[model samples]
Target: MKTESMSSIPAGNLAERIRRTGASRVVLQIPDGLKREAVPLVLALRAEGIAVAAIAGDPCYGSCDLALDAVALTGADLLVHIGHAPVDERKGVLFEHLPFDFDPAVVAAAVPLLGGPAVGLVTTVQHAHLLDEVAAVLAAHGIVAEVAPGSGRTPFPGQVLGCSYANARALLAPEILYVGTGVFHPIGVQMATGRRVVALDPYTGDAQEVSADRLLRRRFALIERAREAESFGIILSTRSGQARPALAERLAALSEKAVVITMREVTAAEMINFGCGAYVNTACPRLAYDDQVRFPVPLLAPQEFEILCGVRAWEEYEVDEI
Candidate 1:
């Protein structure tokens, strides 16, 4: 297990910053996987005379009910979320810090010898901190690499959740192999770039190569599973009308005509919290990409939802449609 130290200097600076801002109570939301380092940061803050509390949960993406319950118990005036971004719908001031260091030498040495003219770089928010360094290393390796620009609509600052890499991959020029880490991030890049991707394991510094064909087949499987389900659930957004309600209504009406059981409603934390069998989103379609939410059910877009709901020959829906 590779590990990096959390910033004590920044922690102190953050403490002073908070003190100047007059916040008395501080909550440190640390992901369970990375708690080994994060615990010390919380201790450092407590030593600074700042009332600090630690909330433990998986920081992979979404809010865990146990973590949320911990936050409610803390009643913190300021929340410092470590290792992940705020996946909840509630809007508030929160700080996110991802403490993972990618060895530049590892990235440089791992550059593929066979890929075409260009290379695209994709990474999750956790590993995004190393983009500049990795890009520089790739440049030195005689490979021109581009960092896929994130979707501008990320709900959290410094956090690109839900198709973030997809947005970046879409923006990339063709004939580029996207380099990413782990199954989720690389697969996301492959989905967006429509190209082969190389995934580097953060832990062992190993590389895994994935082809575009495999990703397409995986997506087909997800769609097929949704199609075989009996009841279809549609999630609506209380915010937008043309986007959420229109899409939800279309899905509901289609399900009714097909004699398939359909359920529709506004997007709620609980919908994810309690876990459903299958759901289609009328709101942000990017929710399908956020694995951190730990959605117990398969969530798809309207068209994908239709396909999953067994609507034969359903047209594919674009992410921008919602």
Candidate 2:
């Protein structure tokens, strides 16, 4: 029989937190990538004589997708959620945000590509801890980096989530350098600010300038396609953090053809069953931008829907966020 590796370990405070809870039973939840750590963590907890209630098997994207319901069902006193910080604080839940470290020298690859006198710096949560080191790297290159504070859904300084680019927008710089892995965020920054964006992958040491032109073109096509729809569904999430009921109601009133639809998980099948020609996502912004291919119909952002309703112009286009 094959054996699993124990090289990796769970967060340090997990056991102590369970002890502090004074709860005999506990439920653990983690993102898909970190699910492998569940067994070991549960075994360790069981060794402590704490009853392992159950593991939340449903897909968890972020702290927004808590397994509170599962906890309630299992009668677990506490829910230990890992891999993301809380977007909003909830009782009976503990958040364990995992951090990934990388060398600050990786910023050297992005400095030469930066164009203006001052460059706004932004990164994902995993790299947010090293913002100071990254800024130091830029300073060594004689480049001034603006590491602005974030607000709303993003609380970490210089950290930009898929749903929020408040940190980058706060800088208002002509050029921005995003030190992260994916081009999706760089594209979001470009779309949100209409500024030049260069993305650097810390692990690979690769750098490239990101353009919003392609995304804009695709969004334009989606908007045009949505124009032909007779009715639209304004999707509102039931998730603790993703719920945007007020915005959903406002958008629903924009057009007679639009109706508000609340769902925990907005799947292609659900949309097809609802029979809405198009959709307006008020949940996680990534669903509309990243998962458009999986959706059968055009899913419009709040701003895009406003443009379609004639309440806002296409020139005022912006990415949707919670």
Candidate 3:
């Protein structure tokens, strides 16, 4: 979704960056869509006399799941993670954020859609690098674009992830502007913060005010379907990050028919094999929200499970984040 992702030739010299690490052997972990570029990159590194010890084949959605195990197993000095910003600190991992750039003036597309005097600004990592420039553009229009300092999983100021909308939630404004491609993050921000959200696709300059009403209606239907489920499978991720074992255990305890299942990848077939009428996903909150169409059965978030169990009321509905 970024302007120049690994899908295209990456912006910086990755080999040079790896060489700077002083680590002779390194593991390369790339996202699924970017794997097409892996062979060329590996060959380039090898031709430069750098030993690429391994290329992790695991599905990598974010920096939250580093290939530390691969690095350790292959005796590699470190790992060069591509396409995402770092979610946490790890000694043996290097991140190439590959942030996207767009016309800073693109903030004007969202101006007419913003309902209030001041607005909080949040965006995906791709657009994070241009936040200050975007703010400057908005300032000319007499709009204050508030960007909160990074904290928790989202380390870049004004950056918001599908699984974490903390940056947007931290804003003090009544309305928020989300600069990115998709409606999901903006929808999540709206639900999580209970604030009006305007989403602008920086590349396309398309802007719209996002609403969670449709998503909530769908989730409510899924919850109703889950209430009739004979068994519940609370998914626990075995990845380096995205693991919520304690939360999974707690959700599993809610129902006698519920059990915790550890998985590296949660697939639709796996749910069918589990034979549970419904499943609760603790791994990657996006699995429950974004990938519900791919799943055959109801896949509820942790909070949605609480709602179904009568622990939380419908009015208290909130988006899942880790």
Candidate 4:
């Protein structure tokens, strides 16, 4: 497996750039998964005599409160966010990077021969470890395969940032096939590739063919219905809405006229970017949970959302249905 820096980002220079911008007290926020790479960067800033602090947690992709607390505590003039871009409304200098690299050999191996002239490849961060191997397999099979860059991970991949497979896919025209472990990767790949795809599980090396036309049709229908609905709110929660009963009840009632989804289902950053008019969360009461991310629309508790949607009061709604 060949590992290379995914982003052409200059290191050590960020602190200098901030200094030039007259910014001091830099707070570096990184995902819990990327601590190994993030730590050294933080220390480097400190070595440069720049005030720096590191926070360990998910950053909820800039939606968690701990992220907000880190910003407030550090009083950071510049926020060097590693792994993720800034999702919060708070304005500051933000630096982002794609922490994982695709193995070239994996990318070479996974192309399929039966799919005619060319193929499309897609995978996630977890399966990205196998890209080179998959690539090698493709080359050996005498099949031309292309990978798309920046299709996954926030900011709409190619539009705002670059993703590995997405970059490759854009560069080459091929029949699309995704090398992935689960539904999400193949689904996303199909959405981006605009082709029927073969999904491969990197761990087990198992493969399956997937069709996205049906799924996309369903999703589009749902989105259209939701958009036209008189009212809409989402029930926000982590994993599931297991913790809050009142919130769930209110959400169910609100759903009659409005669309409701979980926080896990929709990122706060996405909500803000999508321009959703209203949202009622059952999870963390704060908009964007921890406050690292902010919502532009009106965010209220489930009860408030129900009222806005003109649904029955929380007590009048059936808790069991929630």
Candidate 5:
């Protein structure tokens, strides 16, 4: 789809860059959305006289989930990771972030929802490139958007991830403007900062105020139901950037009924198989918040588990972040 990035090689120079890597064989990884282009992508490299050893078939949610094992088995010298920005540095892995472009002026739809003269602006990696343009659009509408730099995990200024909202909280503005697709990010920001947030869908020009009230209500009820559980399985992810061993261990230590369980993928089937009545997810924080419906049992976030154990009060509630 005519992508443009130094890391994300356009078809014109795809072969040349692979040759520059000095690798005899390469392993390619693409996110689920771009998997359909796998054949053409491989063909393009082959036409350029590049040796593509493999295309990793597993679901790649982000650069956080690396296919190192695929590279190791295929004896490939380099890994072409697509569709995400680098969350951490790892040798032999090249991050090719695919940025989604849209008319920045579409952010004007949020102007009506913002309260103050200024607001904090943040977005996911796909839309991070348009942050400055989005700010300019807001500024023209008598609304100044503060585009703050994010943590190392999110290198781009004003970018926020599902597990990291440092950029939103860094801004001096009272309210937040999130220019991205999903309500998940804006909802998380609202919960994280307890500040007003308006989510703007850059592509659709749809804007709406974000609230955590509904999510918190559901979680609060789930926490109550979790009390009936005889035991809790604390899930620890093995994904490169998502693994929080210390946090998982600490959560496991909170109660005698809790025990740490290592899992590459926390599926409903696996949870049912583990036989735990409830789970305390320390993996990708989004799993506990976003995909809870897929599981039959209650999956609690680290912060919710704290409230359940009486270590943290409900009044001190906060969203789970890495």
Candidate 6:
């Protein structure tokens, strides 16, 4: 519930955008971590004579998890999705970029640990605005930090998402410096680019070199266990942005035992009900890599499934991205 160092959440652009949309009923949806700002956001919107239909209370992981069902239930004309950029140009949904402030000088703490003269810089959306300052800080230490142009799910240069690391892979830098909260992103960057990665927690001032060896070992074990399965449930996301129908179809064709299963939220219970001996997650890449312990069976990434099916070799191991 603590907002930490952030003083006030800005509503300047939000109100104007809402007015432009001419929406009478709006459903405000925000990520779970920023749900605290919903009340103030609703107040500001209502103050402008915009009727708040309802707040999308479901857990929002990213812009991909648009609260369309909630918007429909409330008969909202517009959905104000906060904290992420648009993954898809879905009608009736507006994405508001939420910026968080942090000192760029924190990059200095990570500079000395960077082993390369030139490094790729990547961060989550919250701190992506500070990339210019971060690059300058790295330059002060004679380190060149290259922030590659963002594409796919990430819309800003140097910005990375848990499900997308296109910005990091674009740079092809020998080493990557990720200024973000968790080790998950940095680890994903390493796997996505096959480069050395260092994660710097801007708030805590903690930096560490990341390795995919541990995750690889764990995935290898899962693949081995999954081989024992009689059937595979190919998880296809029903979310507006996370859905990869074509990829799911391709993966399903790989094995006769595989069948496509669609769900809004991929959970252990759903996987259990499907009664598949194993699952291949084609949804958010994190569900397989990060949430494996929470899964009832081996939840493999698409590439991992290919490996299990003998189409791809273990040496060709790659991280799944939208």
Q: List the residue pairs that clash in candidate 2.
A: none
In terms of lDDT, model 3 sits at 0.88
Candidate 2: regions farther than 4 A off: 1-7, 20-24
- Worst ten in a row by lDDT for model 2: 2-11
Please tell me which model should have the higher TM-score, number 5 or number 6.
5
Scored against the true structure, residue 218 in model 4 reaches a CA lDDT of 42
**Clash pairs for candidate 3:** none
Collision count of model 3: 0
Candidate 1 lDDT over residue span 69-136, tens digit each: 45567786665655554333443235555546767667754576426356666555666677677778
Clashes of 4: 38
Query: By lDDT, is 2 or 5 better?
Result: 5
Descending-TM-score candidate ranking? 5, 3, 6, 2, 1, 4
Residue ranges of candidate 4 with Cα displaced over 4 Å: 1-22, 36-41, 53-59, 62-69, 85-91, 121-174, 179-183, 191-194, 200-233, 236-322
C-alpha lDDT of candidate 5 relative to the true structure = 0.88
lDDT of 2 at 113: 85
Candidate 3: tens digits of C-alpha lDDT, residues 1-322 = 5343233544247777877888888998998878878877777777777888999988788987887889889999989998898877778788887776788997898888887578899999887889999999998999988999998889999989988988998999999999999899999999989999999999899999999999999999999999999999999998877989999999988889899999888999999998999999998899999999999999999999999998899998989999
Backbone clashes, each candidate: 3, 0, 0, 38, 0, 0
- Model 3: how far residue 215 lies from native, Å: 0.5
Model 5 misplaced stretches (Cα beyond 4 Å): 1-9
Candidate 1 or 2, higher TM-score?
2
State the lDDT of candidate 6 residue by residue for 160-251, as single tens digits.
88888889889967999999998899999999898889999999899999899999999999999999999999999998788999999999
lDDT per residue for candidate 2 within 82-181, as digits (tens), equals 8887787688887777789999998898877887578899999878999999988888888888988857667788888898888888986789999999
Give the RMSD in angstroms, all C-alphas superposed, for model 2: 2.0
Name the 10 consecutive residues with the lowest summed lDDT in model 3: 2-11
TM-score of each: 0.66, 0.93, 0.94, 0.48, 0.94, 0.93
